[model samples]
Target: MATFATSDQLLVIIDPAARQTDGESVRIAKDVLSAGAAAKLCLPEGPEEFARALDRRGSRRPVVIGDGRALVRAVTLLHRQRELAGCALSVVPVGDTALAESLGVPGGAVAAARAVLDGAERRLDLLVDDSDGVVLGALGIPPAPGRAVAARPVPIASGRPWYRSLVRTLASRPARLPAVPSPCAARLRVEVDGRTVVDLDQPVVTVSVTPGTDGVASVEVRPLSVGAEATPLLASGRSVTVTGADFRYRADAAVSGPVRRRTWRVAEGAWGLVLPAGR
Candidate 1:
């Protein structure tokens, strides 16, 4: 799948979170993009409209101007529609730009806006799970020996950052999410390409997997040692499977699952992202 647009006809979707986080940056990006391209701007109030914008975007290039979660939401929506690789997606990162920055999008809105109008498409690898979920960056499994704290409204105490309001809404929800995994040792089984690197007998401190070069994932499993900490087990493979008794994992910016088992496979060049040319 590949995008057909080369010139600057754009569908600029400004996610609401970005508008809430930093309106000035959003305005600046909008100005730059409007000045440079034939832009159709969409100021969606929420996720449903944000998604609909993409579904209706004909041949116009989609340039997302928002925070990390918005970027993930855009990609996730397109991917679910099976159009991820078919379109070249650009982003003008606003708040929490780490994931976009890592993929070569500039951190500054103005610069990112310029790149969106004049960038080359770069096909990137992303992890796809059996449950049709994706991890855009790294994935981790941390140990937790105890149950989660009773669910309640974590008071929006003073001095919490603006971004935390979004986080607070998510964290303080009625449904109990898996508690943030503790640092304690957890019994888990991790396998890379069918070889078991970590067995249930061994307690693990953490396990990490990231998309690496040449269509494989770089996997690292660190075991918990009683004395004189043990070395981490490392391997790379096209597929990884993790199993344990109800565990949670940190995938990119969110924590997911108390699943008994999950499997992820590398989808080689399965999605395309727009990046500054010569990057």
Candidate 2:
């Protein structure tokens, strides 16, 4: 267990979705946090209010009470404000906890709350895109011809201040994607740190990128095959770029796409999270 300073103040911002889905869990988390330290609670009904609540937080560590999407929203908000590096964030997972679990956060509300009170600050890497979008977990580009190249009319991240549109998009259920014909290999140009891993002539089965140690991203590109085993190209670098005919990619839970090209770079230790000691 890690020791916390008595003067450490906490700002508990409970998501409306969390309250609606799991009021009991939210209440338990609140009670645990309140008993553990100096805490101020804010219940934001929407994205705008969430932004405002964060802006009003004064010297208090921000603790989000929701699922993975909520945690992403909070991190994106802080990243947009250029405060992520300086802020230590905490989360009490209430709904879907997959993302939180991947980040080593406790699943139970009480344990998560206790972590917020006593956990140590851990700096983690982030994947930043050219469009100013952030990915906390992994990004995947699957081999689905038309589906990969076709762009969705609506963008998850829109031109809203403090990424309110992105927050709203994530808060709501994603629309069902239209059924595509079938899966086929896509010819994409993949590069890692300016080193060409595959050319457009090579059909790629899938591409995956995730944060790696030492401020680099681990990239893998699997080539298409005909009932035979094909080798996957693996590389680690600070940046990875993919170019092809319009394509869509999955970042965490949200999908963005139909772009000719996209690049992601590792923002080394750009954000801090509260986790158990020795995590």
Report every candidate's CA lDDT.
Answer: 0.85, 0.87
After superposition of all CA atoms, the RMSD between model 2 and the true structure is: 12.8
> For model 2, how does the per-residue alpha-carbon lDDT over 3-50 read when each residue is reduced to its tens digit?
456358989999999999999999999999988889999999999999
Residues 1-279, candidate 1, lDDT per residue (tens digit)?
232333569999999888899999999999988888899999999999999998999989888988778888888898899998788888999989998888778999888987787777888898989988888888989733345466566565567587677777776778655756545778999999999999999999889999864689999998887678689899999999999999899777778888999999998887778877777
Candidate 2 matches the true fold with a TM-score of 0.82
lDDT of 2 at 258: 83
Error of 1 at 180 (Å): 17
Error of 2 at 75 (Å): 1.2
Our model 1 lands, by Cα RMSD against the true structure, at 10.0
Candidate 2 weakest ten by summed lDDT: 143-152
> Model 2: runs farther than 4 Å from truth?
1-3, 143-184
Where does candidate 1 have its weakest 10-residue lDDT segment? Answer: 143-152
Q: TM-scores of all models?
A: 0.83, 0.82
Q: Local error of candidate 1 at 258, Å?
A: 1.2
